[model samples]
Target chain A: MTALAPPRLPTILPLGLARGALELRRFFRSRETVVFTFALPTVLLVLLGSVFGDHAEAQGVTSSQVLAAGMIAAGIMSTTFVSLGTDIAGDRDDGTLKRLRGTPMPAAAYFIGKVVLVAVTTVAQIVVMLTVAVAMFDLSLPDTAGDWLTFAWVFALGVVGCSLLGIAISSLARTARSASAVTQLPYLALQFISGVFVNPITALPTGLVVTASFFPVKWMAQGFRSVFLPDSMAAYEPAGTWELDRVALVLGAWCVIGLVLCLTTFRWRRGQDG
Target chain B: MTDAAISVRGLRKRYRGSRRPAVDGVDLDVARGEVVALLGPNGAGKTTTVEILEGHRDRDDGEVAVLGTDPADGGRTWRARIGVVTQSATDLLELTPAEAVRHFARYYPDPRDPDEVLELVGLADAPRAVVKLSGGQRRRLDVALGIVGRPELLFLDEPTTGFDPQARRDFWRLVRALAAEGTTILLTTHYLEEAEVLADRLTVITDGVVVAEGSPATLAGRQSRPALVGWLEDGRPRTEATATPSALVAALGQHFGGEVPGLSVRRPSLEDVYLELLSAAAPEPALATAGGAR
Candidate 1:
């Protein structure tokens, strides 16, 4: 007689990956998130680059390369801060998180799936944006592998820090519409003062520069500039120094602060006591 | 024989800033393979009690054991043994029905075949896209997901709340099949007909307490209550409420010395008993507690 088959054990990776892929598909299918994450960044990058390319010295940069670096930083900002913030708040408001909490799936597994999807989408956005900058706008690549490595690490850290902050902010929004409005303010204001546009240190008041530096936007842009621009490029700046070490410290601080806030305030249910 | 499917005592929960409790001192028990329904009106603590038992919410003071473990501290094993069908349907728009079911099945140690569950829920023909399914079909998919894990005890929170008549009957068939297969079920619904047809026993809760509990016919001693006999007499409507409907019918026949005109007999139905229970449990709306309502 033939023997019976042995019992099978559950495996979680394929399941996690499948879940992440579906979430990514859902994200892309939503026209609002797509326009904000993909089209909006491309449009903003092009519009800002063209408007100020010829007037570099007046904008505190000798070349367009500095502006390109800042714009790439802006793209990272939008991915981690704006897109993730609104998405978390929307899920909380719609009872999706409450529903998921009832299921048997591990909570960590769900978060890992979200992070995986974010990684894939964020990388794609970076590549598409950089390709457009290089081919259309004559932007140059980083001179060495070390520069690319630095860019990748900074990008990863920036995504984590901003996404955590986004999750934290989601706890404050009462509804999806309010979440959208509340999250956009940071994205717009940070992009302006973090030197994505004209240098805020020169154009804005000193107090604003000092205040914006405490945030992740300025450090991310400074770190991006450390990779793309030449070593002597720091001489032409308002800060007047590269301050590579300071960029690491400031971004590191933002990452810690964001994580703490997320852990403390992130909620699975919509109402305060639900 | 020693294994009770579910047990709870003194289950209490209160929302912040709420003066009254949602689930206050509720005691419940379900034997192995028994199908029990919790029948109550809106604002009853049925959802809160079920959620607490599912380990999704905390209770203030309770001794609860589901599948032989305290739900408040039950970990992965306890969760794997329980299946919960929530009120909201799956809103994952990108995944197909088949894909969603398979994804959820992986979360359990032992899961049923995805195709078999799909067929059971009558979604075999429409497993491609969840976005394409009709309302009934979507609810069927929800059931499929809830049961694909082959849970020992299943909690269905208002499962048929939005179903049409035919769909509701179809869902009853599914519930019966699962119960026959020895899957213990605990359901909550607004449909009295459903409870009358499906539940072996039921408990009626109001204002965070049980006012009545028994078999459908026996609750509030309804089977022994007076029945109504009505007919047309002298072109006018005539009626009497009596303990013996047949006796009243026979008396009418003797008085007329023939069949009574427009003879009809009616008894207190499950809905009647349910309404009476609600009214008796709380005489005024002031007794209606806050939290866990709509």
Candidate 2:
């Protein structure tokens, strides 16, 4: 009998891009995902801004400005961490991941597709948040190029860091329902402790502050706060500073650790413990 | 390239925290271009063995080769030449049959045309969303994706479970078509009729070990079993199992002094022989002491 020749390896980039496009299309098609990712944060921002009013002696700025800046970070976490974590778990439970594993598709290509989806959604969420904040609440963003540069890096790092963590944490969820429920815990807890809901970060207990510092959410909120808030508002934060360098360092570290954890623990099958 | 499309020996696997090994010291081989069915009841190690062959599960101890390559070491190039239809339903609710087929086609080096594959699988006019398709249509979509790559060897794990009669027949026809195209198929099924119709040979397993292996007609010395001869005598039914039903019928004809009344000869069905083989090889309680027993 003659052995059949193996097929040539297909270019991974095109395949990855195709997968990303498919994911984006599916994301947009789902009205629930679109509303949760794009609309909910802006609505929450407006509600909080209206209830708390703009002028606050704590930061010498409107509460809307503080919440809006922090809400962008919260939105990134929701899109990348909460949404992705649940989606991956659902895919695993439904055997989609296993079907993909059976094919010649590379695992990295699948992950690249997920990253692309997160990036696209992140940009859209940021746009909506900023547009609503500026148009409705008179929120002022960064006026200098350097501040914009900081915004870009923080945004990029925040998404990447949270997405990797999402992938890693998804392995712990054996079912789609559990994934949705479990992700909500971190998403809500981070919102409260990371100052997404509160104005003065220093007002929180030291233990809670230290615990929040160990995660990327607080750093991401601080990074965005630095970009959107004026230098005088740094007094509201711990250490009486924005700690921009620490934001970069902490988020960068989480990105590295999250990547390692995901690479080691991600599974194509739902029941696989590893 | 080896003539054997699949070869396994001394295969063993024990699920974590399980008392008995799921697979134990099983051996199997399938010649190139042949359709072989692994037949067993549920939890009889058929899935475990097939998963090992598909490289989806790791075997604890075994020598296995599929298409001349060890599946444990099977890379993307190796994977491209084989297709697998797993037991569980694939959930691609967002994609239409055409879209899914087209997307999977890109993963192969030389995949069949997506439209042609869709037509072949009888999903030419599938619904716009897969979630809207019937169960049979969804299953056909799975088969479409499996064969779109034009794999040389295909592994089908209970492909017809939950299919309607017409759908099952259509799926059998599809399998036959693939086999006619020289694809070697290893299928696992509990349906005796399905195995008889689709497989060129059969491998019967019980309690993680192969108890019988041969063509459907000759498995477990089925051809050697006596045929049952029956007739109507004195307005009452009479039956007898005889080694030579033809000779018995001749004698019965003479006794009747003419054409026999309602005479018929019946051989043992494959299902009967399969059940006997399984019962004969059923594990005794003492066998639990075996090292790999659990």
Candidate 3:
């Protein structure tokens, strides 16, 4: 082989939250992607709340409040996992990722942008759902600042976990159409099992509760339950325990697992074997 | 050292479960400031070779060096040095042209000004909303992003596939300007006219191997091939093939004793040479017929 010329070194761009913000701005501008990201969760929250109006009072809880928290979690999952996954797959399908691979941008920067986009949208969606729930279902705000902090950390971790999982799944989808279908399946299943529609604590089997605990969905829902459900309601649990600390640890574990999977499996372009 | 910008030797790639290699025993050296076009029909492994060079895919065997590093092992630092325009639209739909360019500009160590790149690609006015732009405009944006980094080398994979005549000409001008500025470019196109107009040298690949390599005028000795001398004979069009068109014209000059009306000499075109080469290597005569028809 002949002597090859040296690569023209690129100036490393600053990678931080501010750059993440810039990427979020770009993501929000796409009406279709945004609608898919936030719309389904919002609509589900409203529709479920209206149908279950006053029924929750009989159970000594508010339907809107439960639905609101669930929708917040669901919205984060959709934006970070499903939407991002499908978008990445679409980019690879169209050779967009292939083009970017030749650029100076570090691969980490790309994921950081995605993380920021997902985080921003999660916050927005949570706020909107909470505001709507407060006005329509007489929902109460968190009792203390610690509760609010717990909510924020759990939401953030959940977003990270979902985003990485989405990236991992994107490696499996060869085309955009198939990615859409594959990504949506998990969210639908998780919603029902983790009390997005009904209280999984009462409606689900003990085996499922154990299985859900191993995943991030149960922990995320339990985090929300800590904020909204009364302390006395702990009696309904199989262990009669409020596992906020355990929820945090589980979600953190999920984030780590997701990161490892994404790092190992993600491809900028579709490989022939895949 | 001749300042070789890209170097490859015994490069080989094979898709999984496939017996045939996508790129087989290919060796190439592109010097700094040289414009080398890779010409090949569909599925001729041009894309696989380019992808390996771009560092987007892993090579199964052999040594391949792009800009002094093996692309398969080059990390993010190596990636920042070159530009790539794939045969596809931009992934970003929401980003405006200005925003997209500026965003990508951040990645390069010595990037060109975003505004200048857009202007050079003739997309200065249409800087906002990539989704709103026309196909030609979008392609220009792709080019703008590719050059925003002020790369030493650029890879253009069928850059003008969807361009109109005017847009294609404009792109050619931009390519010429980039080459004049000492940027080594590798372009792959099915358009022989594009190679004729832009490339200083070209390599035609067939069946994962180079069939010919030279200046367009010299490849297959197209310039020296038999020319078709056509003219009006007794109110009817007639043509004759001869290795020496001047000699044939002189003979006709005596027969007519004056200017031969509607007389012209046409050499074998780049397409003709390309087709002949494809025909000889075609899997079947029927396939060759459809290939040339396309």
Q: Which candidate wins on TM-score?
A: 2
- Pairs that collide in candidate 1 are none
By DockQ, rank the candidates, best first: 2, 3, 1
lDDT of prediction 1: 0.79
For model 1, residues B38-107, the per-residue Cα lDDT tens digits are: 9887888999899898887888998998988888787766677788887774476666888878777777
DockQ value for model 1: 0.45
> Residues B160-204, candidate 2, lDDT per residue (tens digit)?
999989999999999999999999999999899999999999999
True contacts kept of each: 0.37, 0.57, 0.71
How much of the true contact map at the interface does candidate 1 reproduce, as a fraction? 0.37
Candidate 1 residue-wise lDDT, A142-166, digit = tens = 8899988888878877888887787
* Chain A (alone) TM-scores for all candidate structures: 0.89, 0.94, 0.88
| Ranking according to TM-score, highest score first | 2, 1, 3
True-structure lDDT of candidate 3: 0.80
Backbone clashes counted, model 1:
0
TM-score of 3: 0.90
Which residue runs does candidate 1 get wrong by more than 4 Å? A1-15, A58-64, A236-238, B234-236, B285-294
User: Candidate 2, residue A54: CA error in Å?
Assistant: 2.8
Runs in model 3 deviating more than 4 A are A1-13, A16-19, A56-60, A271-274, B232-238, B253-262, B281-294
Pairs that clash in candidate 3: A10-B109, A11-B108, A11-B109, A104-B80
